[model samples]
Target: MDAGEASVVLEEISYFEAVLRMLCAMLVGIVVGVERGRNHRPAGMRTHMLVALGACVTMVVSNYLFVEFRPLGATPDPARLGAQVVSGVGFLGAGTIMREGLSVKGLTTAASIWAVACLGLAAGAGYYAIALTGAAAVYATLTVFEVVQRKMNVTRHATLALDLECKDLSGVMHDLNRFSVQQNATLSHVQFDETEERGVYHLTAIAVFRGANPQADQAVFLEKLGGNLNVKKLETTQY
Candidate 1:
């Protein structure tokens, strides 16, 4: 074959291989993404799939530059490309984490994104089995483990931020103490912030319940507080 024809054939083969790698990465990402989607996580199927595809593209490009464009006697290190993917994905994961009052959400989602990126790297490197296994493990953790955790008596505490406007501090404190006693919750920490508009008291409490019932109790607490004339704006947080 002519040199030009040979070069064209090689380019076509390379393009086909890159596309295959991207498809494999996307499939693995979707496997992980389905689990996140079922849990209503912030970074769902589409987000994970895109991240995996992007990682695969980066890995493929890096591999091409190292293997095909080596200069003189210098050997290119392909592993460095994988390392870069790990660090670069961190920025994307950070965007998923958010602070809502005292509680921060999307941590699990961020971790899942990181996991998906790793899967992409594995797939890009032609380690299909490893990538698939990792994605399966992630799915199990998000599905089975989560259910088991919810069933167990894990002392998962969530913080609630309450902003109350009362006529005076004395009346508000009295009502708060009474409410705590009734709810079987102890006020672990309390802080009062007084402004011109009203007096704001932030209460951090620990409520002991049999199993997963604290969330329901929190809703009831908010409802009761809202009904009271002495209370103002109340916000609840779970981290």
Candidate 2:
């Protein structure tokens, strides 16, 4: 067969291989995405599947270029495009993470996005073993680690931000101090802003709670503070 004919034959063969690789990548992505979805994570099934599929296709393209150009006295860098995929995936991962007041969310979801992208690259390169192993590892970390963390009474440190409006600032501060002592929570910071309204003070405090039942303690503290008639408005957030 002539060179052109031979090239056509190889291209046809590659098309079949590409289909398999893309499908494998998608499957792995779906598996990993499901675990995140169960937890109501932002980056779930569809997001993960797309990341994996994109990475896989990029790898296939890189490989194809290397093969197509190698015999034409061209030294092609197969890793060039794949390298881009690795770095480019970071932007997508960043989108999954978000911070609201004192609470930050989507860290695990971002991690999952990055992991699935790597798995896709592996699957596209025909490294089924690595891809499957990675998917399993990702799933385990998401599901099993959570159970272990909860069972071990892992202390999750969160920055508690409280906003209070009160006519009696001193009395409010005193009550907060008493509540902290009761809950064994530390007041890391306290700030006050004098509002334009007479006798109205905007008090902001940062509390750090560390214990087996910090969340429960926080709820109780809020309830107690809310009961005070002097406290006009109270808003709290766990960061």
Candidate 3:
């Protein structure tokens, strides 16, 4: 066969192979996304599937160019587009991380996103073993290991962010100090803002609680603070 005809035949074969590769990539993405979805993560299911599919397409295109341009003496790097997918996915991963109160959350979700993209590139490059293995790893980290992590977290001190709306600015700081001492919680990052309406104010702080029963301590803090006549509103977020 002529070089042109040979290229056409190879392209047809690659097209069929590419279909399998893309489907494999999509499957891995779905696997990773499902774990995230079960835990109520923001970047779940559809997001991960698309990332994987897009990365797979990129690698397939790169491979196609490398094959089609060989007769023209053009050396196209097959991994060039795949490398871009790895770095370019960072922006998308960053979107999954965020601050909730004093805690940094969604870091695992972000890393999973990046990993899923890599899985796509692997599948697109026809490395089914690596893609499948990586997906299994991601799923294990999100599920089985999570239970281990929770068990390990029992002795860890927890941080809580407190936002308070108070009816009186006068002597509230002393009252807050008294509350902190009573609860045996360390309170810091305190800031108070006053409003135009006299006596109305806001109080915010970071509270650190020790011991094994932080949930109970948090409940007590909420109950006591909420019951206070001086506290018009109280909000607490745990980390």
Best by TM-score: 2
| Location of the lowest summed lDDT over 10 successive residues in candidate 1 | 202-211
Q: How much is 191 displaced in model 2, in angstroms?
A: 2.6
TM-scores of all candidate predictions against the true structure: 0.70, 0.81, 0.76
Model 3: what TM-score?
0.76
Q: Which ten residues in a row have the lowest lDDT in candidate 3?
A: 6-15
Please give, for residues 1-239, the per-residue lDDT of candidate 2 as tens digits.
Answer: 34585477457537778898899899988999998887788888888999999999998888777777766767778788878888899999899889876667888898889889989999888888899899999989988988987888666654689888998888988999999888768896699988898999999989887766888888777888899888998888767
**Model 3 ranges off by over 4 Å:** 1-13, 163-184, 193-202, 216-239
Superpose all Cα atoms of candidate 3 onto the true structure and report the RMSD in Å to 1 decimal.
Answer: 4.3
Give per-residue CA lDDT, model 3, range 104-169, as digits (tens).
888999999999999999988889999999999989998999999998875667688988889866
Off by over 4 Å in 2: 1-13, 156-160, 167-175, 219-239
Candidates' C-alpha lDDT? 0.74, 0.85, 0.84
Candidate 2 has an lDDT of 0.85
lDDT of 3: 0.84
